[model samples]
Target: MLFIQNIYLNKFLIFSSIIYLIYLNNCVYSIFECAPQETATFVRISRARLDGTPLVVSTAGHDLTCSQYCRNNIEPTTGAQRLCASFNFDGRETCYFFDDAAAPSAGQAELNPNPSANNFYYEKTCLPAVNAHEACTYRSFSFERIRKTSLEGFVKKSIQVASREQCLSACLKEKEFICRSVNYNYDTYACEMSIEDRRSKPTHLRMTVDQPVDYFDNNCLNRQNRCSQQGGNLVFVKTTQFEIKYYDHTQSVEPQESNCLQKCLDSLNTFCRSVEFSPNEKNCIVSDEDTFSRADQQGAVQNKDYYEPICVSADLSSSTCRQQAAFNRFIGVSIEGQPVATAQGVTIADCVSLCFQNLNCKSLNFDRTQSTCHIFAVGQANANVKKNPSVDFYEFNCESQFGGMALCTNEGIRFIVNTKEPYTGAIYAAEKFSTCSQVVENAKQISITFPPPNISPNCGTTIKV
Candidate 1:
């Protein structure tokens, strides 16, 4: 196991097995800053080859030398000055560089693992700690093992491995495709690498009680960032589509619901509060208004679904907001104050968004019965805030003190930041503001805040921070 650490210093130590590194230095503290040289880093995946035609291939003796080669080269074939994002290194010599255009999905590569083939694949990343799952201890990886079942089809590769461990190891090391699930036959010692799993291909999984085959779906993929790592998950409302009554636009997309949501999340300079997607028609309509924003505008739509992102609010049970501004929910009550703004129809989410967007909007009241949204400059402490059975009140948290807009991390961790807070958590550092910068201009200088301590699972894995 050859490990390379300290890329910024341009030096590396070759490790036989594992390396424990610890170092300290004085640096400006921020909500997104990393402790210098505190953790051992490894960039290359052992015995793994990324699946793609290399943009450039050259011979280099050392791993560090190959790394430099990738950074120095440009897309000569296309006459474009594109830098490589990843590279494959054959242990001895040979370097294959791949540009961003040819890069794999965020947090994934179509890696082919070959025990006989001595190869290593390295991708440049700012958050090496978060993305270095392959380099972590084998025990850190996990899978949902199901007995008497097998996910059929979509098998790109199958091989004979010694045990369940080796089978899983091969799946983890594969580079030819995103290996989502695996089928292992203990009797035949056959390992099947599948690109689809129960989540993506729900119907493909079948019961095989007679066979000695068991299905194992990789859990690591479930931890991949969503909501741009903004600490929220997509709430799918089935058979119910939001009507596009405000700031709505239509686009053609793949027939996947997630792709439709991606359009909403990926919108530039605009907040896509909701989306209506039709898988059958491959149509997506991203809108700034959801049912809560304009309750009368939405109705049932067959063959389509609505999606909205819900941000993680403060948990008063476990942590306090230091009495600094915080999101607080009040049921059966409404803030009574001079209206900053009022809408005829709105929901709690709409009220939250309105309060979040307007710097002056510190508190809001939503009347469920009347579907009315009222924003206020005052908060719950105001004496006028009185009981109203149909009204729900929400106050803007610290987001108002700073002009922080809602942003997502590459991994879908969400937080409101008006200024760049140094990332104090040591879990990860992004190569750049990976996903957020694409949606917000000049956002590369910003860093993601710590996500919730626990991510609720949709595909059977809870990520604990």
Candidate 2:
């Protein structure tokens, strides 16, 4: 028994000596190591605060302590496990930790830079490879700085660039995609070109306190380019209707097509919905009827094009007007039909205003998920709506008419006219009348025995003076 105990003791000593030597050489203690491995990285922005309800709020001695506290905190509310994504240090004692649920995207947690507030915002970001480090000493680009703000989810392409100017230049020169915004990383020297802007993706504008990055919008896009490229103001379509005459308010000889369009716009006395310019005759006809209000009258005419104001820049507003038209709001409903016109990167208020501004727009369908606006002229019956949680429907309760005044004056004799009905009048090319009384006399000679014409009987009434 004594011999067996001695042998066992010798075996235990040998095992202990081997384990200590291994520990000395590797310099590792349990799962924790003395040397650096992969660790979390954060971007610190001064005088800023990430806007959200804190998931875990506690007092800490330092910002690092607060960061560690957030890293270990499990979401206490939803029972489903979620990790902390951001935190706000008050520059004094309080630390506010936020989970992914509180701020789903970094863009949603946009930092509000307050001049008076002395707070620092931080967010977790992707770390470099193990044992790899970025110098993060790249020169900062100078321009109109929207500090700490990042545009998310609209990146069309990503490339390595030396400076922010090159990034912006790359976006401007991009021919494959319509680049409207750019995100440049100072640490990685990466340029991310985006197809959308803040006006297009307002909600996607997020606070990027997790990485060293800058954002810029392509303000070079002017109003004319906007009107031409995106159908910002006027939209042209083909029509063949040639028999329209009663709706014509005025006709004049124009040297150019642009002059004809300008004449229609300058008509304060009459609401001109469309204009027909004949290149062969240099004849311009301004009318109150468009292809939308009078869809049945549309037909192809030789060497003539029809233009409608889908969106007027002067009249378009991002404000919701409830008094002009009665609208029924369906939060989760979408109208089904071929849209008369569609506009992208607009808000709900803008969509409502667009529908109200258009004479032909009977209803509108807005996609909350995509921030798109759809205008409908016809086919908005009850059966067209479907269940869509991300869509909202609104229908304008009003009659479709170009309600305005008309002025016809000769030798200080002025006559004003107004109508709210479709045109119904016969054209007499052979007869010539000098005055309003002569026209009345001719009408009396032709239909004296007949009762008043029921179709727009009050359209061409005139008084003899």
* Cα lDDT tens digits for candidate 2, 89-162: 76555677775311332334556535333466765432223221221111001112356577888887999986
- Residues 5-90 of candidate 1: C-alpha lDDT, one tens digit per residue: 35523443434112422221111111112234221122344446777677777765444455544443444334355455667766
lDDT of each: 0.53, 0.53
TM agreement with the true structure for every prediction: 0.25, 0.29
- For each candidate, how many residue pairs have backbone atoms clashing (under 3 Å)? 38, 6
Alpha-carbon runs more than 4 Å astray in model 1? 1-132, 135-141, 222-465
Which model scores highest in TM-score? 2
